[model samples]
Target: MTDPTPLTSLSSALADVVARAAPSVVSVHSHRARSTGFVWKSGLIITADEALADEGEVRIGLPDGSTVAATVAGRDHTTDIALLRADTSIAPVRLTRTVPALGALSVVVATTRDAPSAALGMVSVSGQGWRSLRGGEIDARIELDVRLRSSQEGGLALEASGEAFGMAVLGPRRVLVIPTATIERVAAQLETRGRIARGYLGLGLQPLRLDDGIGAMVMNVDKAGPAAAAGIRQGDVIVAVNDQKLSGVRALLRTLGPASVGRVVDVAVRRGGEPTSFRVTIGERPEA
Candidate 1:
């Protein structure tokens, strides 16, 4: 063999990082499908919500080659995350507080079999906190320049130093890193409430162009829903919610967070060229 080379040294270091982080990575099985997850807390595992099958039991295959039963504690489909409570204790991975720099080397680790699988890639994009396309708040926006396999949807993303950036999920056209802050916040809520309670107005809305910008046009109203009871009729343009200007459909959705449910709020609308307002009671979102 050639004398010790820098390439060899780098390979050795990567091996060590994988060895140390593999214990926290797990294979999640739901509805006869397999994905990945990492231990979040003592008995909680976080995975991509979309990867889980809707009709079957959930289980976790640990790194030690044993499997344990798991239950879906809660899921936030807006962010595409799900929390599972494992029957046995687990070693949670160390999450890095700082955002990873752009173009930095990173690895995605998954526990599909007895050993961990890793994919090396660079941080293709990193930016300040933002919201997903669906209106879910994310702490940091990160995208990896790696094509993730179907089995690695919920794997852990780590920096070169073995510090975890977050969990990886496939977005509409790219792979996204679901930052640790989002994970922790959603996990805590799931652990406490077992579900995310979101407020709903029960109106089918479409975006309409306004001279100022954009507004939501009420296309249909549920006769028995909150909006209908508040006299919000079709053909009305919602201008604002609780004093916040409504620019588009997403803005309205963001305003109706979980805390807004079951609370009375003012809705400003324009009907027939005249401005009107209604005091509407926000209702809990119905099950899908």
Candidate 2:
């Protein structure tokens, strides 16, 4: 027999990797959503929170054409990770802490409603830790140069060596891989408490450009919230927090991440054009 060409070798290697990882990848079904999920532990599966239906009967379609009922153990929308509790014996994927290098080849082993599926792509962008738009702290920024369907949003992003690295989720304009570090952190907390604790100021803010700098004007204040107790009122234009000048509305919101809970900070505001400062204690955001 003639030796396989380089192209044939590459093709066979990719197929082998997909075959090795496809068993742990399952299709998640809900009343209004169908997404991919992977066995994170013996009885827990992790999937994309954005694709999971808020209220529905959830089931996982296994590799052997079997389906099992699952319940929402926890879900964090900020990081877009959801944990499901199911009675499944599917082997959990052995994931690596390796961050995908930029331009490196990768594979997403996922599942459709019927069977296992695969998407071949490359690591388009890789960078250091960054925060999401919803103020979630992601350990690394890994974007994939591949087209993924809505049903395949929560697939397993893997290395060419068949080593699973992270869970792939849909991003605004690109496919994002939620690295192992983030999944380990958020999923642990969710499994323990069923929710991630985030800081809250209880003040609705709008961005306003002042003569000196940008300010966030308080549009509404929760009557019994921390800001109200600190004397922050509606129409008060907040100029700074902890002496750091305000950048914009989004910036202010980002500061209220999990680490800010119970922390005290100086909030400077222009009330009736009078410079006033209030020491406010950040509180936990109430569950929706």
* Whole-model lDDT, model 1: 0.87
Q: Which stretches of candidate 1 lie over 4 Å from their true place?
A: 1-3, 206-235, 242-246, 259-266, 279-288
- Where is model 1 poorest over a 10-residue stretch in terms of lDDT? 107-116
> Judged by lDDT, which candidate is best?
2
Score each candidate by Cα lDDT.
0.87, 0.93
- The C-alpha RMSD in Å for every predicted model, in order, reads 3.0, 1.8
**lDDT per residue (tens digit) for residues 1-288 in model 1:** 779799998899888888888889999988868899999888999999889988678888988788999999998887788999987677789898668999998889985553579988999999988877666778889999998887899999999999997999988788999998888887788899877788889999999889976779999998989999999999999988888888789777876767788899999999997999999999988878
Residue 82 shift from truth in candidate 2, angstroms: 1.1
